[model samples]
Target: MTSSRLDGTSALVTGGGSGIGLACARRLAADGADVMICGRTAERLQAAAKELGCRYVVADVVDEDQVAAAVRATAATSPLRAVIHCAGGTTSVGPIPQLDTAAWRDTLELNATGTMLVLKHSARLMARTGGGAFVAISSIASSNTHRWFGAYGVSKAAVDHLVQLGADELGGAGIRVNGIRPGLVRTELVAGITDPGPVLDDYLACMPLDRVGEPEDIAEAARFLAGPESSWITGQVVNVDGGHHLRRGPDFRAVFEPMFGAEALGGVIPEE
Candidate 1:
């Protein structure tokens, strides 16, 4: 029943097995784009692709060889109209003094390097055929940060810059590169950060919307960027953080205050 804005377009989404990536894949498909999804897990990728009426590929973004292959695979059978790079994660969390070098490296590899790989192959393919749209998933963490978010924030910062660089180089080829920086969205990835102490509540207090973002929220933005609606936009990092970045973030403890009750604020941690 939904009208499609991309009836003849095609898109490839990395990390499309779940979370935001899956959401983007579904949205693109709904918009009538021929979608191709890539993930490290074959089963998950296949399932997601089937559910979305899209194609599937198994590849790790951090692997250069695999990245090239993924691009070729997706391009071979589709018109290659757009690309959504969403394969990234935080490898570690903690103060700098306690940060693990390997973990930090892994974070950069997966986020920054991986983004470059996807864009690289996509750009090459798009260049040959004139041009296409490329959108990357960044994070609000890139601008606002805490002690434990160093690696994650830095990696996203790189992604933001990468978008600008892509715009500079690829614009001539008719390609538009942009990014979407989202705040705390409920996803399986967030569930693993138990020590963060209710990440959603921490973000909700200061966010103007007083609510956590949904993957669909980001999907809507990506849809715009991919379609002709945003044809004139490029090299921009759009904040989809429910205005969380507009206001000053609460103190670390204040951020988590919602997790505790009135009694806890008054005097006690409260017994479970």
Candidate 2:
């Protein structure tokens, strides 16, 4: 179905420089919202902004001062109607013993703390006008387990709760808060893996839909959460995982066994 539901509305998307964020920004713009894309990288943000015909802001969500500034800047230019928290990254991967403290902390700050900042500032502004929508991009990892994904998963679990807290508090004020938890998606980050081919094949095998996710899949969900169609849907965590959550994940053991030799079978506790 087609929608001009967001006509005259304005949206600010963090991490909108590429990937799912960019897809959501463009979709919002097409649906009639005046969109704003923000990211730490100026060049990438500008390119994305230009493509979507939306404004761009350079702000690292992990930096509170930068986040506040970005919020103020967005407020100065438009009547903000929605905020999509998509700025995040997993800088490291390993079991706790092998994990770097700094990387773990950064992951928490970027995914959980950053989302809190965006929600806090945006809710304050949107509430002043008596309402808006806030949609966070969480991950299936929040409810799933994986090797070397502990820090990232924990942070996202925090985000899921945080989003609900925002929703519970703001729903009375007419501001709705929700989030989308996506499974394995095809993006630059996923492509960065050394040998994603076999791993992805295994992932696809477990999905009921038998396919990997795309940025647009998540983007469409974001648009729905942002628009009036979901007016009564607050404090919800929608999974756009192409049915991956319904089945067991790939056999990481078989995928990584050869690479790690006997160690993959000997010492490590196999993940589900």
Candidate 3:
């Protein structure tokens, strides 16, 4: 019989409605895994499921009960072998001092807390099935500081640490936990930016590859960690950033100041 990497196993991808999550789902399904994607938007999930030939659950990761339910639904299909947490984004952008408390809380809740909840429920299910791999979508911003990425950066930093802690805790259970820190990738999130050209230019200037990342770039790394090929790798944060981590990221303050006004940025400027 011809063999595939994830044959006879099922994979779960959060935020699979679009972007990196959807890309990961596609990769996993292509590898012969029965893939299920979950996110808050039912329409997007349905659309993505059809396009990728996978299943989907509409659930909010921040809600523990919903997350648990999503896991249960996935496990009902087959032995869950892989989970990719891609359900997070930054809702706020500005200087640290100017950032609203709600933005900070939302950032942490969605990125950090949501990751923990997914890990918690997915690990439990995996434990019952003799363990699997859990991969969280983090950001290069976690370590690379930029003027307006403070909240987002801090949340991702927490995710990185959580991946390590989870690895340590779940290792004995045969579960491996890891994270992927992606560089600037064009996604719906970035598409929301008022003017992305200058920002894209800034990122390109710093990227050694001279190009921004595609969702597939991160998805491929996620596939490695999720499959048997990386059975020994865990608790690691892989930078699939096209070498952008070696250089500074885009200056959001600079790019948005003209649109939002310098005063809105609270006097923040990129360091020389």
- Candidate that would win on lDDT: 3
Best by TM-score: 3
- Estimate, for each residue in 60-171, the C-alpha lDDT of model 1 and write its tens digit: 9999999999888887866788999989998665545446789999999999999999999999999998689999999988877653454988999999999999999899
Per model, state how many residue pairs clash: 0, 0, 0
- Stretches of model 3 off by over 4 angstroms after superposition: 1-4, 192-196, 263-272
Error of 3 at 133 (Å): 0.2
List the candidate 1 regions with Cα displacement exceeding 4 Å: 1-4, 192-199, 249-272
RMSD of each: 6.2, 3.4, 3.4
| Model 3 lDDT tens row, 1-272 | 32447888999999999999999999999989999999999999999999988999989999999999999999887899999999998887766656778988998999999999999999998998899999999999898887766589899999999999999999999999999999978787777442456667677788899776789999999999998888889999999988999988666665667755787577654454
lDDT of 2 by residue, 1-272 (tens): 54546777778999999999999998899888888889989999878877778888899887888888787777675678888889988875654445678988999988999999999888888888768899999998887766656489899999999988998888888999999999887788777432456677778777889777889999999999988788889999998998887876455655445655555345564454
lDDT of 1: 0.83
Superpose all Cα atoms of candidate 1 onto the true structure and report the RMSD in Å to 1 decimal.
6.2
lDDT of 3 at 104: 87
Error of 3 at 158 (Å): 0.4
Worst 10 residues of 3 by lDDT: 192-201
